[model samples]
Target: MAVAPIIVHPPLGTGGRRVTAHGRILGLAYSDGDVIEFLRRAGLPDAEELLDDPSWVTWRGGRAHHYEAA
Candidate 1:
């Protein structure tokens, strides 16, 4: 597979971070749990643990799993 196929985009001005897979939008994540849920729905049952795995997820505009502005 490709590195960071899943991307958690920067947080929006209001709230939430956009989550995408292969450039396809999956949903917005307001929390780490929300991110995990999105990944779970995308077929990654171990998303919670994979949150810090750069090989699977790429965090942009902020720290990994962080949905708040930096």
Candidate 2:
């Protein structure tokens, strides 16, 4: 049996929560430096602007694994 990976949207603000398939809520960090560090490792340049705000949070819902900006 394979455990599905939890889907995470990019951090929108200082903090957020992501619900996993197993129903666990993981805290999403959004400190400017922290977000920058994560974005640096994430390798997505398109999201640079989104990481600047300190009060934005993202999330995805439904049975499907598609994540959209929130």
Candidate 3:
């Protein structure tokens, strides 16, 4: 199965998280639920599935960010 890629940048100065899909910025998220909500708003087919998977990691720089179960 093909998985949709979710990219998360470092936290903003204002404490919001930037989320991206396909190189396009979705929006800023204040929490994990906000991330998922943004993805859903963006119409990503696998948004829920992606977050539901415990193995999924939002990558930053050249490494995976620490996983925090939603």
lDDT of 2 by residue, 1-70 (tens): 4433333444344334243323444435333344334544555354446533323323344222232334
Model 1 TM-score? Answer: 0.87
- What tens digits encode model 1's per-residue C-alpha lDDT throughout 1-70? 5668988998898888999999889998899888888889989898898888888888889666667755
Error of 1 at 61 (Å): 0.6
State how far residue 63 of model 2 sits from its true place (Å).
Answer: 26
TM-score, candidate number 2: 0.28
Off by over 4 Å in 3: 1-4, 52-57, 61-70
lDDT of 3 by residue, 1-70 (tens): 5534677777655566678877788887667677778888887556666764534435553223323333
Worst ten in a row by lDDT for model 1: 61-70
Q: State the displacement of the C-alpha of residue 53, model 3, in Å, after optimal TM-score superposition.
A: 4.8
Better of 1 and 2 by TM-score: 1
**lDDT rank order:** 1, 3, 2
User: Considering summed lDDT, which 10 consecutive residues are worst modelled in model 3?
Assistant: 61-70
